[model samples]
Target: MIGFKLLHEKNHSSATHKGTGAWFGSKPINVDIGQNPVFLLRAPDGSVGAAISSNDSANAYKQALITLVKNTLDRFSRGGFSAASLEAAMLGGAENARWKWDRMLEIVRNDFTNIKKFDEGGLYYRIIHFDPKSGLAAVSRKKANPDDWNPASAKLSIESGTKGFSEGHAGGVVANATRFFREKTTFTALREVVIPAHLAETPDAPFLFWSAACSAGAEAYSYAMYIHRLLTRAKATCPFKVFATDINQKLVEGAKTGVYKANKNDIGEYRAYFRRYGELDGDTVRFGKEIRQFISFNTFDLKQRPRKKGFRMVVCANVFQYYDDAARSHFLENFMSAVTRPGYIFVGPMRDPIIHALGLKKLTKYKMFMVE
Candidate 1:
């Protein structure tokens, strides 16, 4: 009897070449982001094959060339070319197709790395890197603007066990607020909304605060702190009410638990205010009696119809970017329908156009606008 290891078995594979001498074999390619570009090849039976990507621009060009080779494989599979004849045709054609050959080679040599596996919509997808300077190729992948505030980044940090209400998080919020304020000013042809002067004056004035997408409770807690400070200073007779909602059940439970790390450095000058108004229980920070009394956190989807009526101010920031244009329009309509007349609506920077289209009167100073 002959003993054979399963790993030693070879699987049947096919190869094809484009018209520019680049060739591809039947294999799964994986792409991901890293300090350098990376590509991984898997055999037809999903065994490891080869990997590539390096610092040199030539590596990027080679990656691009491989992509073209893959395209040729797809074309050949579609009956456009015979796999057996592909290599000869491509090598011969490369002489006359110098531009295609050079372009393919340049792309493969310059802009590729970080190969990883991704599963999306029941299909596997690979992440690939391209040089943004390479024009349309680079633009194909969404790249973050280094200077722009990304709420998504902040959320990721919070989810990764970082303190959510820290100065870093607050700074992200402030940056988002500033950007939204600027965009609102330009879109509405009005002045920017400043942090409400009233916030400093009267925090306990029955505040009807609405946090539309209060994911994981960071935003709600931040607002609670803001209100707590205001009310403490005012020695106000009346209390405020915060209506915080999110689509995520897990985050809603977390918010209700009110547990968070006490990071004084992250909260900044608000540390004093938090100490005065927040109660610490283990790693969780609960809003002080005064602030807690006013906040009602719930699980609600912004895309759905509003359940409550008569909100004075609605903060829907960071929700719009998650939605498509049509969904955004529908959401805005629902939002306007839910709030009381003369109520304020605050959105993130990117939703200015959608906000304006809803026919709301833009307010100055706080990145807030009136929908009355």
Candidate 2:
């Protein structure tokens, strides 16, 4: 069932500063995805202003609305539609409308389970229903379970293959890095930036690389392999540590072990890099003396502030898109605070605005912004 609600009165106060459009007079229209569609329109006052029950309504109308949304999205692209126009046009056709939250909740509860309120310390918390596939739906707070308050479990599904993890975007980061840096900058230049001269000086000074949102461990391992090759080439006498983290602990653990199903395209360079650094032992890729001394792995959330600092470089690639503007800014500020001066920050492609807005200079190499 689709559900929409206006920003709660409490949320309105925060939304203004958070840059949420719902508090800026933009109403939210939620459309549910299922065999039968259900739509709810919520006002700015956190009240359900209109409802369209496609399960009981005419199939033709539901199909028509679905077609309209699809066509509109296709024509204008995802960000092109005006919410007001779409809401006005869609709700104009509703009949026998009702405004009963209790009844609506009752009807939806019939087949849904684990319905509860999910709060991530934000203004956008909602009541959800837990489904097998899409997982959980946000429900009102009163119906939520206190024991199920953990956001990590709520966010990730039990299945593997990066279904619920941030791997897809992390993979996109690798692709973008390949495009922006690999093609544009030489491997020698990348080695210099990533494995900087200062880091090489203190090769055993417990250097840590945190991939804050490492998905399926590809990027983290890629980094580990890169460092291994650098130290091996230099014939360094010390080891460096690399830590891969994710909100999902399972993926983080997987990364620590360094075992993965290798796709030829994705794992090729990583394998070659590993060959230079150390040896691949069974499923796990182990680092040698030069790289192993500096790398470690752990689970971390970007939203949370890191307890320690003095990291030489932090690779927070491509994780910012998951956050809204305010959250992004807060995390970036925290990142700035964590890295020591002359330390490097590697952000994803889409994060130029936040990166540049903070007055961080992009390291230039051959006229390209190169961050290791």
Candidate 3:
């Protein structure tokens, strides 16, 4: 929970730290004709973050950045890493020193391509804070605090039901890169191994599946269609449901409608199944009551305990690759608690090695972890 405040005026300064401990660059101090813009950088995997309270001169900015880069690699314990390998963001320069910021920004642009800037004309008083563990860089002109933050809870920058884009955390839910049937290989594995075992074990028992981080209910509906077809073919009298949850309320509401627009190309191999589950009109697909009945969509965060448990399989197909070692372990432990003894956890194709490190047996073919 320790935090450092950076205020650069006459000289350049830098700070780098481990998880949860934050580095913040407050409003720029005006000592000379030019003011320093706060520079921030983080590794691609969200492992380490470095912040530089930059000097107005381009050479000072460049030197401070390069030193911070080496220090960041040391923190990551990676021998081969540079600022070019990091995501960058810069914020808050003096309004009159906008011209000086141009050269310093150019120096930063040479090192980072995936960058965010808030040093514009009106953002002069803006305060920027970054938590590397959560990959949160909150920026606002209003009084903001990063010290009183819990990495597990996103309550610092935004309240749960707030409207508009979430500043630092995962962009915004509206622009989610999720659709029906993302991570095709993971779904294939779900059918081949997990489904059959669940059906055979208790032919007449209620079957349950939980889709964590289900953006817009792509995987949730896809699971419903697949299970519905399976139950029909097997002719087994078993009650079943898929519980889909996301942290964003807006996305969960949109998913409840079960209306997706996907063409033949986007539908790909699941086109026929898509037709079976919903009323299809060209590219507009409406999943009516038939498919919608099997899924219960709600706004739920993985960090919180589920009200219901005993999920046969918990498919958290994405989001792990963005987390660091400690974060991945924390989430995985929470996931384990909500699953059955003989259950499985699907963590997608970009698999986390910690799955095996935690000694959860791997269903290697499907790239999932067995709880037992």
Specify the highest-TM-score model's number: 3
RMSD of each: 17.2, 15.1, 13.6
Model 2: per-residue Cα lDDT over 1-372, one tens digit each: 223233332332211111011111123323221112233332223322232333222213335444433343344334443334232101111011111112333343432332332123221223222221222222332211112322211122122213323443322223112111122232344476646654645656655555556655666656665665676677776646666666767666665664445545534545666566557654445556654445566777676788868666666654443334455566666667776555666553323465577777776552223223
Candidate 3 lDDT over residue span 236-329, tens digit each: 6888999998877888898998888885776776778777877778787889888888999988766666778888888886455333345456
Candidate 1 segments whose C-alpha is farther than 4 A from its true place: 1-205, 231-236, 280-284, 351-353
lDDT of 1 by residue, 264-368 (tens): 454553455556667655444666666567677897766578878766567776545323345557766777887765566766432346567788776645556
lDDT of candidates 1 onward, in order: 0.43, 0.42, 0.59
Q: Give the number of colliding residue pairs in candidate 3.
A: 0
Give the runs in model 2 whose Cα sits over 4 Å from its true position. 1-190, 197-206, 235-239, 267-271, 274-294, 350-353, 364-372
Error of 2 at 368 (Å): 9.6
Ranking, TM-score, top scorer first: 3, 1, 2
TM-scores for every predicted model: 0.46, 0.45, 0.54
lDDT ranking of the models: 3, 1, 2
